[model samples]
Target chain A: MFSELNSILNTSPENCPQGEFTLVSDRKADASFLIHHFLSFYLRAGCKVCFLGLVQSFSHYSAVSQRLGVSLTQAREKGQLVFLEGLKGALGVLLEEEPSPGTHMLGFLRSPRSDLRELFEFVRASSTVLLSLGVRVGAVVDFAHYCRAFVCSKLQGNMVMLIRGEDEEEEECDEEGAEWLLRALTHQCSLALRVQGLPTGYCRDIHGQMEVFWRGHGSSVTGPQTQQKLFQYKVHDKGVSFFARGTSSAVL
Target chain B: MLLDIMQTNEVGGLVIIQDTVDCCGRQLLKGFIHCALKRDEVVHVLGFEVCENEFRGGLDSKFTQGLYFHDGYTDPLGWTECPPLTVHHFTPQDINTCLSQSEQLKTVTLVVDSLSWILRHHSPAIVCQRLQELRRGGALRSVLLLLHSDMHQQGIVGSLCHLATAVILVAPGMSGQHTVAKTTRRTKSGRVTREEECFSVSEDLTITIEAQSSCSGKTLPEPEEYEADPAANLTFNLRLSEVEREAKEKLSLPFVFSQEKKSALLHPRPGAGRILYEPDDNDDFDQEDPDDDLDV
Candidate 1:
């Protein structure tokens, strides 16, 4: 249902789109549950994923992957699997640029943009803006500036931006983000600009009309939605590559 | 050690304030997290509450999000009121419904902060089955259950240890607590090495590990330099030949090696059917003391 976002600290989006993550007293019994369900979804979906904050070598993913015949090395080289350190580097690269404008594979998500350029020039003319977690307060204020011209899309997506803590303001992601973007769409709201964050899920209605999101610091969000946040990498953990960039190409 | 793995990004580390945030276990968790932030790439702290459930004499969280993060500071002693980077909350029922709804949901890592309460809701088997479901999804990330060390021996917990990809056993050693991460799922054919480590949870959420003074003046790699990933593969074979040496040196117990493990420890026999029957010699002495004092 989504790109795998497995992490010791995060829930892999590949296995569960609207998944539930819990921190129990002991993870031993539950380790397999996470791996199986997540891999079932991720392998079928063909998403590039990562895992972060897990302990030891052959800890979780490696143990299972060795059993399943997946290669951590192949995944890493092919851009499918990743670790926390790799995730950090990816984040660094993405945040380094402003999101590129044009037709995108994951929409603007896979689309690369740099911070070195002057932004907000295109967002003012856009109707909806999808942002990343790394996008700071920049896109919000920019979207607010165009709030009258075009209704802004809610900030939520895979590989997204969020506060590092647990208490983010609650919003119905399925209903609100999609509905608001569509409402803005019907009115032909123009100039939607998002902060620069490459969230993990698909944009239900915010794509065609210049969707905007962010990739900067903010309050952490929790509840089941917290699980939806990116884990370091999903496919990366399994040591397999070959994820689906195109919406229809995710192969099991 | 637990502190090393806890600091690494491959694991989810937690500290629970039992009877107010200062249980010895909580101290262990705090100390480890404080040190982890300084050494790892990215460390996240999921801060949840444990308010008393007056009716049930239990605990629950104040907000929906059960997670919070405290980024490492230049110094662990400093504190701040700044909002956390992430927070997520949910009801129990919603949690179960999610897995069933997904077509092929892959839930790789499920790090439980405390097994005590979750176990309170269901059995270790129930948690185990859920984990089995997650493993059916795809490639697993890793699973870490952050519970007090005492739970290490419970059958319910032992079963979890049996199912764990890696079991990180931490106990207060002669010089604080030493962690031994053993992979229950791994069958490594290499030399196993054991080393001592120090722990402290900084004011920030990172867990710090310092080499014990015994190994001082020796140059060692930083926590990350220990290996590509020492924590996940970090194992001390409990069933290995070296266990006796650890018991003598680290555990300080009379570990008599025998053909079978059952004969090692003296514990109460299994329950008969659904009943528990045992007599403690300490209770018999205490019972006579009260009567003797009463001149009965």
Candidate 2:
């Protein structure tokens, strides 16, 4: 499903680098395709995947991954995938009585102050997996920081995070926090994939553009030379096609 | 030039290494560490972004004898029980206590791995005040701060820049060969110097600095001499020769009438009026004036 993206990244599913942080972000465009690509990509690599699904429920991802030829239900049955449905968990935390300390994964959401220690502890207990946090980071910027400090530094595992880019209509404070989180993650991540809409407005042939920035320093598994490239992409039912700028079919 | 500034210890007060998302300043931070160690000064690193081993991995071992690492990365909030050095508070007093734990009380170079983390947790005003208080205490020789410029608001970053004695901005160069560092330094005599240079950090933590191509010798490039030419390489001639000019003046176009022809067309002599009439076969000719019967 993501062979072209893999080729552009210069890595295969079998040889995916560990202990690296990959950040996927989008602006004025939907980047959910990238989240699905990484999910199926890592699962095919035979890594234990713990997906912190914050934006959607299990069935939605399951349906999408099934189209991409990866069975999330079977993976769960085999004890290789740990799925945390954030919306359902938050609902449960709201309806249920007060739980014991550090028992629930969404305990931080219940507290008045923003603390993610329990969440980090939960991830630590489920150790040595490719942790994916699919959430809007405007509310929990510190959680991303904690993940960078603990999961990437100590656990020796890879992390893939999805964050929405800034919007002009959003509140000033939330926009600032989201922008800051995006920049901070870009500085820390080994690879940054940014998807943005066409500046000239809506288009028929080309969906959007993506910029891939590979940080050279601190990434030993990848090459030492830094690289930045731009490509135009179109999302399909099962996959996405990435081509160079001005090379879309309509333009030709 | 940056190397010279670092070697001479001309930068004092608070020094900031401002970097963006594309380019990181950790290499420059390590270069500063190398300079401090070469000067035989005690060095203390308060690392919150990266662990101790990862921070000191590429540094030379012999120069690390005077270096001390305080562990703020492992458990900053003290969630775990036995962190070697926990950082539950960010007050200047707490940080001073952490620094005083080292046996050497002499003048030391204090390096904060990043000020962005601290700024995120605390208000910018409180952080700035603490930094000022830390600087005025007289125990530290100088303070080096690493700031992610894009991660903060313009006002916050501006305040930090205004507070610093020098600010070095690291950005990716045209190619990957070297990164660009633009340094803005304020001297003790209230003079300001700004220099931009390209530097590359080697695998062993050594930096090679070179001036940018445009500002290599600190002399502005001379402007090229320009001359105007309307028909530099045209195939057809745009200029007229003297003979062609005279011939053009003598020629009279059909639509342009002479003075005599214009006067003759506008007015005729008194007795020269005549009408040439050829009547058709169906026409009737009468010697009477046409309007005499209707009006006399």
Best by lDDT: 2
Query: Which segments of candidate 2 are over 4 A away from where they belong?
Result: A94-103, A110-113, A128-139, A168-176, A217-226, A249-252, B10-12, B85-89, B100-107, B213-296
**Tens digit per residue, CA lDDT, model 2, B27-112:** 78888898788777777888877777777877778888878888877776567788665444666677677678666655587888
Give a tens-digit lDDT track for model 1, residues B1-296. 44434434342212221111111233344343333323322222322211111111111132212222322111111112342211122223333333233233332233343444344335667766765654443333344445543322356666665455345444333332232222222213322333344444333333456445354334345666665743455556444477676776664334655445555344545762455657576545456465653555
Question: Candidate 1's chain A scores what TM-score?
Answer: 0.26
State each model's CA lDDT, in order: 0.32, 0.76
DockQ for each model: 0.01, 0.24
Across residues A1-252, which tens digit of lDDT does each residue of candidate 2 receive? 489999998878889776677888888898888888888888898877888887888999999999999999999999888887776787778778666443497876666565766677677655334444544434355565567666667776678888887754343433346676777778767788999998887788889999998875453422223578999998887789999999987788
lDDT of candidate 1 over A132-179, digit per residue (tens):
222222223222222222212221112211111112222432222322
Runs off by more than 4 Å, candidate 1:
A1-252, B1-4, B7-23, B26-109, B149-153, B173-196, B212-296
Query: Could you tell me the lDDT of residue B54 within candidate 2?
Result: 71
Candidate 1, residue A201: Cα displacement in angstroms equals 69
User: How many Å off is the CA of A143 in candidate 1?
Assistant: 48
